[model samples]
Target: MINIPFNKPYLTGKELFYIEDAVKKGKISGNGYYTQLCQKYFESKYGFNKCLLTTSCTDALEMAAILIDIKEGDEVIMPSYTFVSTANAFVLRGAKIVFADSRLDHPGIDEDQLESLITSKTKAIVPVHYAGVACDMDKIMNLANQYGLYVIEDAAQAIDSFYTGKDGIKKALGSIGHLAAFSFHETKNIISGEGGMLAINDRKFAERAEIIWEKGTNRSAFFRGEVDKYGWVDIGSSFLPSEIIAAFLWAQLENLEDIQQVRIAHWENYHQKLQEWTSDNLIQLPVIPSYATNNGHMFYLICKNLKQRTTIIDNLKSEGILSVFHYISLHRSQFYKGKNFNTVLKQTDIFSDCLLRLPMYYELKVEDVIYKITEK
Candidate 1:
């Protein structure tokens, strides 16, 4: 039996070359040449006002929490069917997380149900673009505008993806919100081992975001001759990554188009091959909303129930094929249990109990994954 791992990080052959070049430049600290290179690449491609590369998506979120000044007693609305980092980021700043449910046809936050959750204490809306699919950003942004709330997009699995708005104008996922975060973790579409980025669309936060990324100092501007002297200016941490990580990320970005094309082809192949099998088995495949474009970050399925999902996983593992389940709703987490924000989430719970992820990676053998899952 051929063992197939769920994810195997891909390299473009230039990772080490760039790392060597970075070392030769003699600066391994953050905000160095390779760091700027990656940042500029994203800014140029996505048209973001500014971009800051962080050590992880969690760091980016924490920076956003600080940038937005999420104080004690403030409320933040986000889907419960997401990674804990999404909630933990705000929670660290003493913000009360107001969890929302997932959509019936999709695992994304149900945009239609958002308005009911807003209150005078609501400060921001953090929408996780689950599986690289865009949440209903138009509704999200409209709500933010109406309620005067900030929008922080968790684009951890959403690189090179797009969202077409009502105006028919397509925008990059990370560029839609007031602030957006992207991950380049080894498990994602891109890999920098452990890395992420924070894109600033709202200009007000651009200058301040850099401060937060540079360990709460004005060091970024001070080095650029913008400030006479830099010191502890505000609250922040060591969010920015070193030149080595940036070098590895730069290599990945250089081949982004090629990588995206290959992953998308694999994604489409899986979708087509398993369509009949999934329907017959009472399983639902991933759904890409009309407004979203497939970046091929992930391909998952909705099993009938928790038992069925577990059975499928065991069957796959027996055949040397690894398959796994996703998040178990934030509200149901061990840490957050009985924290008083229950507010039953039907759709979120359903997804939490049934979502299964098959092998999805740059070098994945889609046929192998399909054969095992569809085998009688």
Candidate 2:
């Protein structure tokens, strides 16, 4: 029997070639030729003002925190149903996390419930594009405008996604927010083992972003010959990733279109075959609002409750298929058990219990997906 993995990194066969090129070129450190090539590819392809590859998505979020100056007592509004890195980055800066609920139909922050949470203490809003689906960016931007708060998109799953506004203006997910973070983790649609990038959309933060990425020094400027000598100027960390990882990522980026097509085909197969379950009220499928474009990052099914979800998970495991649940809401975690919040997150609780992600990867065949759902 063959075991189906929940996620797997798909190599495009250029990894070794690029890695060998990096080694032969004698620059395996961060920001080498391959790294610059990957950065330029993202900047040109996505229209991002600047992109810096980091060690991980966690590191990218931490960089965004520094760029935004998240400080003590500042409040960062975000959904509770997200990876801890989404909240941990700000929390580490002594900022208070104001967790919001998810929307009923989507695993994104409820825009309607966002306004009342804003106060003078609110410094930013971190919107996670769960499952590569775009959030309500227009409403989020409008709210940010009204409150004078920064918007940092936790777009870990949202590379290559787009949002078409009601006014018919189309914008890429990471390009709209003041700052955004993307992951190229092996579990994602793209893979670089454990790599991520920070997308700086706001022009004002471009130069400072480079400094922040380079251990808070003016070294980048010095290396560019803008300064005769460089030294530490502000607080920063070693957020940059190695050239080897960047080389691997560049290969993935070069084959982005082809990989995306394969994953999208697999995603559609899951949806089409599972339509019967939805029609019979046995399970709920992932919902893509009309305004957003799918990026094929995740495919999930919502069971009636936690028990049913557990049953399905065990059943799938028995059949040698790996499926999983995600995101125990941070608000309910034992660490924050006694903390207070503005409002109850009803939808987040529902999603935390009911949602189950099926196996999705570039290599997953349509027949394999059909077999998983249609068998028993």
Q: What CA root-mean-square deviation does each model show from the true structure?
A: 1.0, 1.3
TM-score of 2: 0.97
- Every candidate's lDDT: 0.93, 0.90
Which candidate's TM-score is highest?
1
What tens-digit string does per-residue lDDT give for candidate 1 at 174-224?
998899998989999889999999999999999999988988899999999
Weakest 10 consecutive residues, lDDT, candidate 2?
335-344
- Tell me, by lDDT, which candidate is best: 1
Off by over 4 Å in 1: none
What is the alpha-carbon lDDT of model 2 when measured against the actual structure? 0.90
TM-score of each: 0.98, 0.97
Give per-residue lDDT, candidate 1, residue 339: 81
lDDT of 1 at 363: 80
Give the poorly placed runs of model 2, Cα more than 4 Å off: 338-343
